[model samples]
Target: MKTKLWFLLGTLALLLTGCQSKNNSGSAQQLNLMQTSDLLSLDTSQHADLPTWNTLENSMEGLYRADKHNQPQAAMATKVVQPTNQGKTYTFSLRKNAKWSNGEPVVAQDFVTAWRRSVSSKAQSGYNYIFSGIQNADAISKGQKAPRKLGVKALDKHTLQVQLEHPMPYFNKMMVMPAFFPQNRTALKKFKSHYGTQSKYLYYNGPFKVTKWTGDNDSWVLMRNKYYYDKKQIHLNKIKYLVVKDANTAHELFSQNKLDDATITGVTAKELQGSKNLIHEKKAGNYYLRVNVRNNQPLANAKMRQAINLAIDRQALTKNILADGSLPASTYTAKDLSIDPTTKKDFAQETTPQQTYNVKQARTLWDEGRQEANLPKKLTLKVLGDDQTITKNVAEFLQDELQHNLPGVKVQIRNVPDKTASSETRSGQFNLSQTLWLADFADPISFMGILNSDNPQNYGKYHDDQFDQLYQKAILDSSNNQQAYWQTLRQMQARLNESMPVIPLYQMVESHLVNPKLQGVLRHPVGEDDYTRAYLK
Candidate 1:
């Protein structure tokens, strides 16, 4: 009996030790995620993609950030401002307690420096057009004026004022974008050309600070900022991200418990439909095809563009190819992104149907286009897209469908790196390219503005006077004309589709496998992921 009791006590001690070991192993307070793509730049003005913006949003904050209910809430600022002087002037008061990771006070001058550089012509910022409503922004972007002349000023250490060229009703929401983020002037001057190019060159005022990204590295770390204004509420110690472009690899990592969040695409999304970890969110964005008309003989023909658009079976792509809950976009702007001020109806649902999948119609249009352009029936066009799994799947699908539907046209699918694809598309180096745009703010104009003639992002070189005029009129109407505003949006969308400069493919839906134990991770379909309050339960 004595021997048995001693043995039992030894067994109990071993069991307790094993249990404690397991608990300690599982208690890591880090959130591991798969990054969307390579983070191109830390400078907010230098890049326009979601990955870069999301990185900036994580490490640095703007005046406002989206809350739990996806509504804009204050970040650096204490409150939202109402524009004075009949909506032409806006003023803000800063939070005195906000400080950068280095313990420097975050003041109003930081905002002034960021806005001027972002709108300057030297930055080649894709979003400079967004600042057109700000006073002297257009002139500054044109190099006709200097950054000092910009209408933003720091009234004091805490007070900031802005003068707008026009009365913009939605200007408050625009503050959420990274372009409005304040950059540390001392840091910028210290790093010179090296600033925002590497993780070490930047400072953080948000919940986290970036590290280990040496300009072009695929992996990085977002460590919790001790100096963060709300650091006391932050639960996670660190957020680590790895650039796993392959969906299979990402899913495998998640299955092995190596990653807390993993994005899945193609058949993977379908197979994981009922899985406990599966999560899907409809995106506020659209993927479209831009055809370069310059030096591209076939693209100049409107009939050719129409034929290409008709050949695409968007419904089949969204439903069959991508089993995710993506929408078949008839218009360029996404659903639920914009609403009529008065009617409160979604603008995406109200636009007229622009294109359709008609094999017979596509073939007829192709023949007509061949004759119209006085060219041979055989046409060879190269299309550039990302080399990742889902994008490759889509490119192959389009190549097969377009060739089979349209007679004698062969599309060579060029798989390039994400950055290469973006540069080539913007420079008009390819015959056709697939690209996507997420709204910087909740505005239909954010989507449509990229297609304008003078817009630098207009890679297709499409120009229409009627569309521009109607769009301008809609933008100028700040008196809450819901009926006129929505109707004008419809007309603008109709004009783009009629011109056939680009073909609207489908809206996006992202699939993720999130750890059930992780709570308050704050996943957004657009800008910035909020992780300050996120905790491992």
Candidate 2:
């Protein structure tokens, strides 16, 4: 009887210990989510992919973040500022209460430092070109000027001033982009080359702080930032993410209640149908093809490029292969992204179809291209793409379509991890590569700017003097003459239609199984998913 009494006491003690540990971990206030790809990098300037940027959006605070209405809202900044100097300058007042994870106060100098570092020639930031209109930014990126002269200054500890080369109509909206996030110079100096490679090497000031990341881990956790300015408003105390590439695995995990949100597409999405837990989110992004025209003579031929573009049946790829509510793309920009101020027409509606499925025309163009270029009767080309289920499916479909429609062409599909595929394509090491671009802001130029001759992201190396001139006019006239700006963009789209440098496949719609109990998650059309205000109901 005495031994039984002791055993019961020990069991009660064990239960109490477990409860204490659970409370310490804040399990009740935690969220579990999934990402389709691994986290590549945490460095805002270096990362070009969506997953990394999305993670940054939650852990790092910028001057602005998108609200539920997809409008710019104050984050690190106390309020959004109106531009001066004829819309060429902006001065922001930062929140004095803001503090970084390392216990240092977040000041205006942080923005100045980060802006300079991003635009520096040595950074090789893929998104730095987004700062094209900033005074001296282009010169600094080209190594012609010092980073100190790159148009940003710390007017005071709490005030930041930015000068622009021209009036950027979207400058306010673009503040929410990851490229504009502040960096702690102390952390950078301490970690040096290893900064932002792991959770411990960096600091955070947003709603959450990354933990348990070891640079190459497939999983990570974000704990609530104790130092955040608006900490009381943040609901989820911890957010966890795991890389689940396969849709079936994600679905199974979601069904088992191991995940609060699961990203599923293709067959799984179609099967889910009308489930109350399922959420369909149409992204302001599009998947497209980049041809290595700079290195390949055959692909450089406009007829060859046009033939390749016309051969793919985008409708089948979207409806049959993707089957996730994705729309077949015709314009570079996704539909409903922007409506013309005067005409009130969607950007995609205003532009003509760049390329359409036409097996007959594709075959004719293929033969004529070969004849014009004095090429062989039979030709082979390799395509590089990510190994993700959806992307791989698309790549395989492209291979079959190109081979079957072009008659004399043999296609090879090479699948690699997203990171390797991105690097290889950027370096011009592939004949053709599959890529996707999401808008940095709400503007159509965010998509059209990729084809600019000066854009580093222009992997295809497409160049036309007239196209370049039209693009510049669009930017310069953006705030001055809206009608001229709109017309120039239309003209640019027509140029792409004729040149066929890049191929537009479809606009992506992300399908997910989110827990019905979770509430207040804001999925923005032009920015990362906002979870700061999310909580379990």
Candidate 3:
């Protein structure tokens, strides 16, 4: 799933409208915030990081945005419509009042243009996979069909129609994703290749507009969009963000009142234990180690991968290193994403052989795998991770645990910026890539599809014919048989546990020191927080 921007929920509208008049006073409504990383791209079709999506969600309006309770709510669309043709066909009537920052009316063709570009063969859009169930999308993505043949069209100026290959139960929830947002053809044609790389090249339709962003700058600002249809409900005049990767630095900025909101973890999170301003948000994402199993790497051996998985102490890492209420992960999927239709059981909580911490067993397996792969007794491997303080701490902890458990193995920790880590991992430049996935929507497929043998996001290059076959079966059953689909998912996860392509680490819990005065800031379970309804009291 492509990373999405954190958008304003519908439920906050009333509260925001009530406080709108009071916030008009100069400088009082501005909210100072901090991000662990800088924005990568403004283009929704290209960005795969959280910060970039967060910025886009604030700056662009989609067909439907989430309500405060995480329910589907209409944004650009006048109302959320029911799917026709057995849940395959959808017709949306967009709000006529909506206009782009450039004063161009947001028509249905904008969506068509963006959707077609995403599935075009030449684009190589990492997110085009999400359009799989849409008619002709798969063919277009594979270059078998033209982009214009994909099953989406603009009926008229304000009407958009979409045809799906199958009945997608979670399709409505996907409308809020950044990839589903419309693109201005005028801007695309005007800026050409430079489009979405900088803030100036894009047009805004959401509550906020990107006023200052140099694309590579660590500091940026979002100002209220005057052209937004619901501009009257917007309370915050400005949202400023500064990249502060160090937890200590974030806490210091928050303490000095330089930042109204700061994400703090590790020692800083532990220190703010009982503070009134502390907000603990358990995110619906998992952090795992992506093992490079391609080209006969040491991790290509299943036994070697299992040995590595068994050697890590997840409990200590989450409690001691993270100290942010994150749960140790036993599987690839995070908790609460889905429930079995028959048993009503949570997908992540379903019983399966667990990932255990057994140093003795790990050591024995390591030796066996080494001999089988014709490797030396002493081996060295490098682990790539983000340079953020919390991530760096986790990387260092993994190094210690692996080296300590496997006597002859030597581990090296390489810390780089988040963008660099993502780039390197995508290019298969590391033995082990410390990465994470924030689901685009709350479905098992969103997480499971990443490890698909042909998935672009499968940075580790792990492949298994059996796993891919089983995963395809699950996809086939998704629209027809819920029970069989759920069972297939369980089986796929079991297969993952056996292969150990990715080491399940922990389910993240974002701990933030948000100013008490900054009311109405909505923190979502799946993605980043929204500041559209926020106000400095």
Report the number of the highest-lDDT candidate: 2
Q: List the residue pairs that clash in candidate 2.
A: none
- Residue 143 accuracy (lDDT) in model 2: 84
lDDT of each: 0.81, 0.85, 0.85
Per-residue lDDT of 1-537 in model 2, one digit per residue for the tens?
A: 999999999999999987655444344688898888888889877776777887888899799999888989998899988999999999999998999998899999999989888888777557778888999988888889999998999998999999999999899999998899999988989999998889999999887899999988899999988888876577677899999988889999999988998988888888885888888898888888887887345788888888888898988988888887888987677886888776789887778573488999999998898898888988888889888887788888988899899978888888888778878887887778888888878888998887888787787788888889999899999989998998888888888888888878898788889999888888987878988778876
Candidate 1 TM-score over all chains jointly: 0.92
lDDT comparing candidate 2 with the true structure: 0.85
Native-referenced Cα lDDT, model 3: 0.85
The parts of candidate 3 lying over 4 Å away from their true place are 1-28
Q: What TM-score, computed on C-alpha atoms, does each candidate reach?
A: 0.92, 0.94, 0.94
lDDT of 3 by residue, 346-439 (tens): 8888834554788899999998988899988898998998888888899999999999999689998999987788788878888898888887
Each prediction's total of clashing residue pairs, residues at least 3 apart in sequence or on different chains, is 0, 0, 1
Clashing pairs in 3: 5-53
Rank list by lDDT = 2, 3, 1
Distance from true location, Cα of 214 in model 1, Å? 0.8
